[model samples]
Target chain A: MENPVQPLEGTTSKKVFWSALASGFLTLGLLLVSFGVSGVAYAVPIAGVGDFYVEFDKLVGKGYTFYPKMGKTSSSDSAPQGTNIIETLTIDNLQLYKDFQVGGEWIRVKITASKPVQISGLQHDAGLIEANAKFENLVLEENNSSDWQKQFQQTSSTIVLENAKLKTHYLFQKTINMNGMKLTVERIKK
Target chain B: MWWKRKFMLICCSLALLVSSAGLFSQGIKAEERDTEGFIIEADRVVGSGMTASLVTRETSKNDGKPMLRFQYNSATIYGMKLTKQVHSDKGPVSITLKAKGPVTVYGMTVDASAISFKGACVKATETVPALGMENVVMVAHYMKSDDSVIDQLTLNTVFGSVGPKKPGQLKVLQDLAGLPLEQLKKEIARISAGHLPLTCEDGTASEDLSGPIGLIPNPLDEVIGGVTNPLDPILQPLDPVVGGLDPVLDPLKPVLDPVLDPLKPVLDPIKPVLDPVVGLLEPVTKPLGPVLKPLEPVLKPLEPVLEQLEPVVSETTEAVEKTVQTVCQQVQASGGVITKELGLVLIDEALAKKVPLNQVCPTNSSVTSIVVKLQESLLNTLGLGNLLGKLIPSDPMEQLRKMREEIAKKPDGTVIYKP
Candidate 1:
């Protein structure tokens, strides 16, 4: 006759196999659920302090396109042959779209700066696009140059924006220095 | 062992499928939810020490207020709400936005509270053709902080075409931006008044008699008087000739009286026959008297001119007779033969002696020159000569040449003048 211990051992091995499979399925399910929830969430808060210099090959937005190039100079005498410098740059409602990879996970995120973004001494040769621009309190002086290329350059005392928003297709940044910086990344739904 | 392995594999596959489904379901749910396009909100935004080069197209319109349209090569905006919705025909389209804020473009600040914007995804229509390819169209109907309307402005990116990479065009629109509404309206009215037809304050079409009518009469009277006074010298010499003729005619009348004395009895018989004829013609001629009465005032001003011209006419006749006498005498002196050449020579000689050739042939004098001088004098007196000179160049030939040159410079097939 077969021993009772032998039958008990077989039953235990089967229970262990079934338990291992259930645990594996549960772990996978929880991971997938967490990823799904994160992807669908409207905002993921990120708090940090850093300064960034970003460049994009092409960024298409609602009413404009941007070709960002940092540290480029105008090929004109009036503008010296060096990087174009902006002393202080401030933007409000900045939005960005980009693809991110974290280890084995891939996420398409829309990052937004919900507060006034301040940057100091940003040097770039980016191209800006606009239509129908009007100026106020403008002062014009002769450049005393005969060449058409060295005609004139415009400088403003200040530029102010109210309730503005921006969206970009891709983003790359080199952080410099920042304080109390908050960014929210919302996963884009396909 | 084989069954357990297959069961584990099946369970892992099932878990993967369930997780993917949950992920997709959540994505779909998120997509279906309605949400605001803007992720940030702010009260104000200020940028310091900014410099940018842009390319753009510009257009303008006047509808109650001046409206400017700008089409840029590309533009990036801050502080805006951009909502995009997928459509069957046009894939994804951004909804129009009504945003409020203070924004600066170029150098001008638009302190508007509300601005309407139609994003670049809109399809091209007849009215707004520049609407696709990330072209942004912004229309700002601005009012001052005191609720007074300022201007209507339009800004957009050029559709499809990206212009030169450099800054092509720059414009300034700050002159009339912050002006008071009432003052601006008054200024517009003042400017428009010059272009529109003359009208009274009550909106009735004005007769506008004050322009030319008020200026005509005084100068016209002075011109007539001035013209008449110059004829006095021409008439003065004729007076002595007439006075001498009167004394000469007195001796002829006495000599003729004796011959006419016997004819009075012969005329008495004819006087009876002439009486009925005169009575019959009286009724027909009576109506003509009143017809001439209306011409009295018109001819009245010309009476002095005509009176001055009368003696000149007689003097001219006498001079012609003298010229004929002189020509005859010269012909007799030159072998008594009147040839065309000899007659011309004699006439030339007579004219050379100041025999008033202008009176004989009026064309010899510049009739237009005289008339123009008179008109110019009149206009000068009315303070209109200089103004008219500015409008119509003093030299007509020069003006015509300039006009021809301008017309020649026009492109071929251009309709410079339409009949």
Candidate 2:
């Protein structure tokens, strides 16, 4: 048995406060957790805030806590208490198992050999959410309309992954290796 | 040598027992549970009370078929690559997943087609195992659901061939084929209504799908049950009124029928005289149909635009009226005259007067007024006093005396600088 790597100690492992598309994006979700014996330690030098994943090869969590937005529209209120995600996610291939509980439960994912992923750029922003809207083309007076335009402020995070790699193996199947993946994240400022 | 042989035998027995226990307890099999593609699952969690799951709730769009959602925080896919060969393809694919804790993916399957979903959304099937520790298998294959969807759209295309064809329909189909897995599940919900038993006992596949076709993009149907036809609601009360009139008409019909029977023979004889007139008009009215058909294409698109603009135009007219009223009031308050034909205001004549040497026009200082009078007297000796009077609106002395008698409200509240 090989020992799992431990990294990101003392630093805050980013907690998810997520939402997806105003339509379905506000409904979509993306969560990344790595675990092993004690607490799994894996190190990536790329520094950023918020959830931005390149490849999901090795999964070692005792169990996952998924709080999907129950409502139709993706709003800050759609996710109550701890799980409010207003975002849009683009996934390659995702699958889950019915059982494998260590106290709770989690699933092990193995990326296919031919379908190695390289997430060069990522934008995790839900589209505009407007309320009390005037006409789309109406040029509002400059005086009091400032408050309404505040909703258009761009507060979304962009993520770029550089030098990414994935190494996965199966007990009864062939192994898959992914290397030299580069990802870029750009911010759209208002 | 006998002791060493016994030890070897014990070692072999221990190894055999362990292997047998693993097989019986876990049911380890090669071809049973394998997923080829990317996977997310709740594998092993740190604490208790943590639950990993796949959520596939249908949304309102794409007939709720596009809302095939993988709501679990963790899941896995053992698709084709996990089997004898590796094949990785893009979407227009649907699948069902069984989630296991510590997230071991099992019993996942896929079916792919050639048509694109455009941006409509793809259809997918999702499954969850309520009981823990159940083993499942992943499978892969191609599907043929696009045939029905194409048939529906082709029917629409034939009917909508006239004007402003929505190419977006084909685009919607093509993009729906590639909609992300979560969005695809939404479409699947619209198609399958959730649970899809894709395979049958005899190894035949029959999928019952009903994609939303040519239905006017109606969000209001799902958006809180709005009034579909505005006029229908207002006119609904008239229906009861019309129905009640039948009883009144029924009693009158019995009495009136016998009285009108004698007129039938006379009315029938005139029909022969009207026949030639009708035939003569038929040839003239035949050309009107083609002439009127061309107007439909131009007016159809503008109908909705006009409806939307009607309220705006009315509101704009009211706003302009309010603005004119405000301006008229402001002008009146500022001591100006306004009427139906014209608006007029006049400045104080003192402002037009030239300053007398060192004193300014409208000056009140006694010292400056004396200096100005002295300058006037000197200029008057040179016959230039008349020129000064014409240049200025009035003498500074006369204007100062008249300022005290002006009307009402302290004269614009005496516009003072804050300083």
> DockQ: which candidate is best?
2
Candidate 2 displacement at residue B81 in angstroms? 25
**Alpha-carbon runs more than 4 Å astray in model 1:** A1-85, A99-108, A113-115, A123-136, A139-152, A166-177, A182-185, B1-419
Interface CA root-mean-square deviation for model 1: 16.0
| lDDT, candidate 1, at B387 | 45
Q: Which stretches of candidate 2 lie above 4 Å from their native place?
A: A1-190, B1-256, B259-419
Candidate 1 DockQ, CA atoms: 0.01
Candidate 1 residue-wise lDDT, B146-215, digit = tens: 1111112111111121211111111112333345667655543553444321112222322343333111
Per-residue alpha-carbon lDDT of model 2 for B110-202, expressed as tens digits? 221111111112222423322121112211121111001000000000100122111121232344556777786575455456443222212
Report residue B147 deviation for candidate 2 (angstroms).
21
- Clash count in backbone of candidate 1: 19
Write down the lDDT of every candidate, Cα atoms only. Answer: 0.36, 0.29
Fraction of true contacts reproduced, model 2? Answer: 0.00
The lDDT leader among the candidates is 1
User: Ten-residue segment with the worst summed lDDT in candidate 1 chain A?
Assistant: A59-68
| Per-residue lDDT value at A146 in model 1 | 32
